[model samples]
Target: MEKAWWKESVIYQIYPRSFNDSNGDGIGDLKGITQKLDYLKDLGIDVIWLSPVYKSPNDDNGYDISDYQDIMDEFGTMQDWEELLHEVHQRGMKLIMDLVVNHSSDEHAWFVESKTSKDNPYRDYYIWRPGKEGGEPNNWESVFSGSAWQYDEATDEYYLHLFSKKQPDLNWENEKLRDEVYKMMTWWLDKGIDGFRMDVINFISKVPGLPDAPNPEGKKYASGGQFFINGPRMHEFLQEMNQQVLSKYDIITVGEMPGASVDDAKLYTGHDRDELNMVFTFEHMDLDSGPNGKWDLKELNLLDLKENISKWQNGLNGVGWNSLYLNNHDQPRMVSRFGNDKEYRAESAKMLATFLHMLQGTPYVYQGEEIGMTNVRFDSIDEYKDIEILNMYNEKVIQGNEDPAKVMQSIYVKGRDNARTPFQWDDSENAGFTTGEPWIKVNPNYKEINAKQAVNDPNSIYHYYKRIIALRKEHDIMVYGDYELISPEHESIFAYTRTYGSEKLIVITNFSSEHVPFTLPENLKLTSSELLISNYNVDKNEDVSSFTLKPYEARVYIGK
Candidate 1:
């Protein structure tokens, strides 16, 4: 086994637009992030994974990068970004930028030239194909709905965009494009930043000769995952990237791979593999996704959640590392999605935190998660700012003639804007997010769930997170321990144990609102166990054979 700085660190993801506002321009910028460095420092964050701040047309909320070298005008100038990097380093915290090279904005110079003409030298930089039989090149569907191929009148061909039409997929088969990407990566690492969180990195390499995906529902378009995810040359390309740029730096790299598997993850993040340090797998996130994928909603299966988490932990143990997270800029808040967001909001939030942070991987805390920020269900679809939500509503309800209320219900629960809403800082008019109008509506619960109140209250979720982070730093077993799932068949209890040499830790979480009786495994004894952390106050001397845990309760016991 090996020890790395990244394995011992905790990452905090900051969605810049929703984090804070400094200029009161209704948008958060680099200066605003600098203003809150001290607050994050107090929260015990070691690495700050800032979402994409590159120059863009705002097509996919900055994921569509038009310029890799420049900062977005809305997020402040190059100097502001420089000061932010310096300040984060000054506080002993590392900063990692989002690497969105899987696709570049259609407005980028490469794409502009690529679409100019068929013979253009840069034409090979993007994936373009002639139409087939008076239709698209393939039956593939865009992640945002409709055909994945967009007709370009200028080039007399269609370009592939797995996401929005404004984002064009890059041709990774081109050596010149790969060289340019590597050079751009080196330029950033040389600029004194940490590393990158690669956006859809696994989708970069595609199978030769684009093919039609299987249509299960007989829809007009099909899921292109079979032809794109972890494609033929993914490892080859990543290794070249590592050899050309990443290998030269002491930085961490995490790939945002949507459809990758445990076997694929091991190859990508294995210690011997010259690729990324870790990867984000979405098996756990997809537990609630129904037949038609994410848009088709279904109730979350608690036992499935436990199985998925435990599988990852066991599969990656000693092979590669894992990146633990329940919420991000793209997903609804964890407390709102997995826990009771009404009565047991705080309790369930703490319980979920205990379950994730005590695992055998580095944990990520999305901004405002420390205060149990729940989902926001705006009254109408027009109130939504996320392109994905709006597109789904338009396609499903407006065009497909589906039930309007039913579609809205899915949007309310799964919309990305639920997490993209401005961070609630106080009880001000705009939740202290901005004096001017916020880019998105603030969650109305901010008055009672802002950071100000959490910071002041010792028993708040914020402080509880702080204490859990401190314990991780203090315990070597947290990072190096071997994990085992206990009672994997338990429907309401998510329980696991971590053991490193003689040190052991038992983490039990009640995921339901009803009281449940918990019986420890016969192999485990608690005579010498010390309560390390718990969401609810518990009697340590109570009988271990039959203990009833309150609703949404979590307890971590440390044993010698």
Candidate 2:
């Protein structure tokens, strides 16, 4: 097997809307990102995967793209984008743009034309089906908690939108639509971008006939994913995309696939598949959700997380690659979600970083995660801006059986906007994100947890992440090493070993606040090992035979 450059690379995902704001326009922009290039460079990341900044209706924040070629005016002009790309390259870093071709905003030209007339040339650009009986084309449901098909009075048909009704799914079955997507992709690749982070790419291919999904709830909308996600011609379309656009560019590609299985992942990212470099699977991320796939106040066990991660690590060991991440634009903060954020935010943040980065995969750090950001708490639902959360809140609580206040509490804790809040830069008003009011409320704890504070504190999570990333770059074992789960029976502690060639690294992390003692494995001798890094202080030349770890403590030891 050949080693891929991206396999050893550390990717930093920037939710541009929250990263920085340069124009005092209440939103982050490319210029602000350009100003932070040095910050990222100093962090020792190789690739920067920015969330979508294309022209959009802001329906799904920026995921519902309306124009592919132009930059969103809210972000900046084309010149600003070019400068950002140039600055990234100048610092020896690569830039990967989000590819959201799975769907486009209903306001997009193609969708507009498709809805205008049935005979329009662009009518085939989007999925349109004649109404069945008296209503929608099918009983499919949108991910945002409503009907998937929206009736168009002008066309006398219903258009499919797997997400928000404002966002219409594209017709991947159309060859012309595929060509148009390829052309836009090539245009960006030609502009010197490094790669793409495909958004919900698996949702592109859908089975024809627009069959009604089985209603497990006996309602119109349950299990609609059967007709869409991982459809019959997904690989066929992906291979065509790779051959036409991706193959010509030596670039990295990761697909956001929710329902994809181990076998499906092997097909999408295997060395011989030629589809993608990696994929972001949602199984680990969705552990806290209810059986209905909605947010629930459920506790995620550390052992379950470890088991799921290990399964993927071992499954993709020799076949494909994995993209490891703890938090992103769609998820809450890692420290708050997985660690003791209130009691040991700093230590646990560093511990979480160590636990994730030492795994057998490419690591992606969301903006502000390096500084141990926490989830936001809004006063009310009106304070939120994420469409999905609002829809869920309304459906499950406001008009349904669940308690409205309880649902709101869950939204405050797990809403996507928690990650989308403007990056807190200082204690200033708006957390120094913008002079004007930010699009989303900044986390109130920004005063103490902002970037300015973290940068100046040597014991901060930011500095720890920087050190860990530098260590990865300096040691091949940290990047390309094989991962082995150790002490799997431990309840509150997660331990693993990474070995490459003759080097061996043992990473141990305490997932809880309580102190725990563990006796070293008798079969393994580590008398010659040295502690490379530790969240808690260690006595000089301390023995590893038996050790007690403080709350949220972690250590990385390299064998001599």
For model 1, the stretches where C-alpha displacement exceeds 4 angstroms are none
lDDT of 1 by residue, 1-560 (tens): 69999999999999999999999999999999999999999999999999999999998899999999999999999999999999999999999999998899999999989998999999999999999999999999888988999999987899999999999999999999999999999999999989999999999999898988987789899888889999999999999999999999999899999998999999999999999999999999999999878878899988888878888999999999999999999999999999999999999999999999999988999999999999998898888988898888888888889999999888888889989999999998899989898888998899999999999999999999999999999999988899999998999999899999998999989999999999998888855788899988888787755698899999988986
Per-residue lDDT for 15-68 in model 2, tens only?
998889999888899999999899899889899999999999898988899899
Number of colliding residue pairs in model 1: 0
RMSD of each: 1.0, 1.3
Could you tell me the lDDT of residue 412 within candidate 2? Answer: 66
List the candidate 2 regions with Cα displacement exceeding 4 Å.
Answer: none
lDDT of 2: 0.88
Local error of candidate 1 at 186, Å? 0.4
**lDDT for position 461 in model 1:** 95
